[model samples]
Target: MEYVEHRMNDEAVKAAASAGLVSPLNILLLSIILYTGYSTFFAKTSYPQLPKPPPPVVFKTYNPHTLLPFNGENGAPIFFAVRGVVFDVTPGRNFYGPGGPYANFAGRDATRGLACGSFDESMLTKDLDGPLDTLADLGPDEMDALRGWEERFTEKYNIIGKFVSMKDFEELGKKE
Candidate 1:
């Protein structure tokens, strides 16, 4: 039992067990890994931008409902359109209810335009909150709005196909 060698080769050193304490080599390796992650993630200074949206296109229309439009008085009509999609552009819609208050512009002719403004039951509120609620909560014009909404939202009501247009939406609303 008298064969005590001294120096270990590089291969043997690499195979040696790690010490119970931290080492400079380990710290350097960890720092390198952390820095790589930081540079890849947090240091992202630029990225490929998304395509710019198309320019706005005006397509105005008339609204002759009892409820006033945006920034307009009650019973006054409003109109404005841009980017192929149109909006009431009328301010203070507190007077018009969803279906009749403001005029939404959506087309299905040949362009298959996007779904424009629409009335939904979810927008109703209990009790009156002034003009907004008064118009929104009333049921006097329920028949007209319901009919118009039905025709526009009943074109597409299946999962097997995609929605063709706003005109093709489901008319599964409650029956009168």
Candidate 2:
């Protein structure tokens, strides 16, 4: 009778262990389902917003003297004149700023240099008050090259202003 009672007690213990294991598994599955439902039906998802771009720059007129300061010096914007147009080349500061390969053209007329494909200082006009380069001596090939450069400039940089002689600038100021 003692042996029979011991066997019965062992069977009861095994049954309890199995029931405990199944209860935990069922509770885990129920918790997962509840969490899934809560997230799908009630939880709000959010995403970060992007910043707006800056407004367009207003166009201004500049002459050789007035355009001289925008040479990427002292934190100034880089500017260069091409075919009587002043372009804000600040975006290309690495190429047109001080210590740059094309720095000689900054704050000066770059037409002759660009047309001749020369980055020499001689290509730049020395006199600020002097008349603009006529570019009359440029051959057809040079003219075409200059046009190509102008188109590239137009596509890359902002046309911030017009390049004019000091005389013309003065006349414009007087008229205004």
Highest-TM-score candidate: 2
Best by lDDT: 2
| Residue pairs in candidate 2 whose N, alpha carbon or C atoms collide under 3 angstroms | none
Regions more than 4 Å wrong, model 1: 1-22, 34-55, 59-88, 95-176
lDDT string for model 2 (42-126, tens) is 9997879888885687788888999988888987989999999999899899999999999988888899999999998899999
Clashes of 2: 0
Clash tally, candidates in order: 11, 0
**Candidate 2 whole-model C-alpha lDDT, 0 to 1:** 0.92
Score each candidate by Cα lDDT: 0.34, 0.92
- Shift of residue 15 alpha carbon in model 2, Å: 20
Instruction: Give me candidate 1's TM-score against the actual structure.
Output: 0.20
